[model samples]
Target: MPDEVRELAGVPVLVCDPDGPLVATEQDALDLIGAAFLGAQVVAVPANRLPEGFFSLGTRFAGDVMQKFVNYRLRLAVIGDISERLARSPALRALVHESNRADHVWFLPDLDALDARLRAAS
Candidate 1:
């Protein structure tokens, strides 16, 4: 992560546009988020360029991330066009539906909406 990215942490929201294997490594992921809320009230990560297996690893990795966020009480919004995943996994669809009902984790379709939601939450 760069200094600019760390600066984002101080803002009210953090929109991430990562590339390659950054999302695959937990340290990289956390580092990217370390400064997302620099001094703001809330943060949101728009995972547009996440590596493969992030959602597919829903049973494992997703669950782990979700738990970590929940434990830290950090709100996260997964912004992506996840229609395919939703169609393939009924369980994932159910989880999305359930998560959407909460303020912490949201599976949104676009970044604008994600920003709006996070801004509203903050």
Candidate 2:
């Protein structure tokens, strides 16, 4: 599926579906950012759309990916419950929890939750 731009509470967001290309790296994220003029402040992508490396702390892919978004001043919402991954790694679970607590990144169960959070932030 193709990525689309959506608006929530006056903010334009880029919503990437699970069937879309994998966003595994900073460069891939930059490509998504490039799709819009001036870029989007927030992006909603399925958890499965991310690369496997993103779930492994030893790989540092999660940190790198998050840093990339931070550098661009963009917030990311990774949707879906990664229960299996969280169960396998305490570190990953902590990271997810911490990211969710921050304003810059969030891990949501669905688009409706993302929309609700965005609405509350506005």
Candidate 3:
């Protein structure tokens, strides 16, 4: 399935397909940002679509990608379970916790969680 835009809680969101291209580099993230520019106020990416390095804080992949979203004034929601990654790194756990507290970046467990968050915000 292709990535498409949908309205969640009255918010225009670009929901990426799980089988879509891997977001392994900054350029790849830029592609998503570009897509969001078309209409979406928020971008929802499946956790599986991201590479392992993205979950590693030391790699700075997550930070850089998230910074792009923030810089572009677009919200990003990483949807899907990251329990194993969080379990292995306290730093990642902290990052996820902090990101979730803000409106710009979110690490949600699923699409339903993203919907709920959007609804709450609305």
Candidate 4:
């Protein structure tokens, strides 16, 4: 399936396919933002769609990609379980925790969680 937009808790979200193109570069992240610009207020990217470097804080790839979304005023929800990765890196765990506490970025376990969050926000 391709990346498509869906309404979750009254918010239009661009839900990316789990098997879609890898978001390993800044340009790739920008493309997603552009796609969401059509109508989505949020972009929900599957964890598998991201490169390994994104989960590694030392690489700073995740930070850069997240900054792009924030710059564009779009909420980003990274969907899928990342417990393994989180266990491997404390910095990443902290990042996820902090991101989830804000409205701009979120690391969710699934679409259901994203729906719940949006519902609460509304």
Candidate 5:
């Protein structure tokens, strides 16, 4: 499946494929704003499917991805378990914490948590 768009808490969201694009470069990140995510308020991407640089605080991939999304006024939810990666990088851990506290980008545990967050926000 390319991607599936579903409604959660009255919000349209596109749940990305687990085996889909590995967003390492700006081009990879920009691709999300294409046809698949049109009219979707949130786009969910699995942490495992993202490039390692996406989790690296010093890497441009993460910033570039977040910037593109913010510019387009799109919300992003990064789902899946990232405990190991978080453990290895304190900076990333801090960033995740900060992201969770914000409304734009979130590092949620899974799709269920994403649903809960959206529901709670409503």
Candidate 6:
């Protein structure tokens, strides 16, 4: 991840999938978000496979990530199939919808669409 950041001549747009378990805490989420924002415009994390106990902590982390992005005015996009999340949490789904309505946070279905959105933003 560090190497990818260093290799970028300009801001990069990171594409990632949540293949492993979801993060456990706000700090961990922040760390990953920070890593992604390093020389990057967006970070795409998979929609499924989030931590089993992600309700409260995940919400907090999402809030933190939003604050960080607002503070720095950085852009980010979370891409993948979010049906699982929607099925589990209506609140989270609402949040995703609202975020996507904004200019910064986006919930897309695939990397290609994400890339298109980022390019459009730029």
Best of the candidates, lDDT: 4
Q: How far is candidate 5 from the true structure (C-alpha RMSD, Å)?
A: 1.2
lDDT of 2 at 59: 90
- Per-residue accuracy of model 6 over 35-86 as CA lDDT, tens digit each: 7665665655555534545433354766765566666666656657767767
**Structural similarity to truth (TM-score) of each candidate:** 0.73, 0.91, 0.98, 0.98, 0.93, 0.67
* Candidate 2 local lDDT, 9-64, one digit each (tens): 77888888789889877889788767744557788889999988988899988888
By TM-score, the candidates rank as 4, 3, 5, 2, 1, 6
Rank list by lDDT? 4, 3, 5, 2, 1, 6
Once model 2 is optimally superposed onto the true structure by TM-score, how far is the C-alpha of residue 66 displaced, in angstroms? 0.4
Per-residue lDDT over 73-98 for candidate 3, one digit per residue giving the tens place of the 0 to 100 score:
99999999999999999999999999
Candidate 5 residue 87 C-alpha distance from true site, Å? 0.6
Better of 1 and 3 by lDDT: 3
Our tally of clashes for model 4 stands at 0
- CA lDDT, every prediction? 0.62, 0.84, 0.95, 0.96, 0.85, 0.61
User: Residue by residue across 91-116, what tens digits does model 1's lDDT show?
Assistant: 78888899999877888887677656
lDDT of 3: 0.95
Question: Model 3 reaches what TM-score against the true structure?
Answer: 0.98
Q: What lDDT score is found at residue 75 in candidate 6?
A: 61
* TM-score, predicted candidate 5 vs. hidden true structure: 0.93
**Clashing residue pairs in candidate 1, if any?**
9-35, 9-36, 9-37, 9-38, 10-38, 10-39
1 against 4, candidate with superior TM-score: 4
Clash pairs, model 4 backbone: none
- Clashes (N, CA, C under 3 Å) per candidate: 6, 0, 0, 0, 0, 0
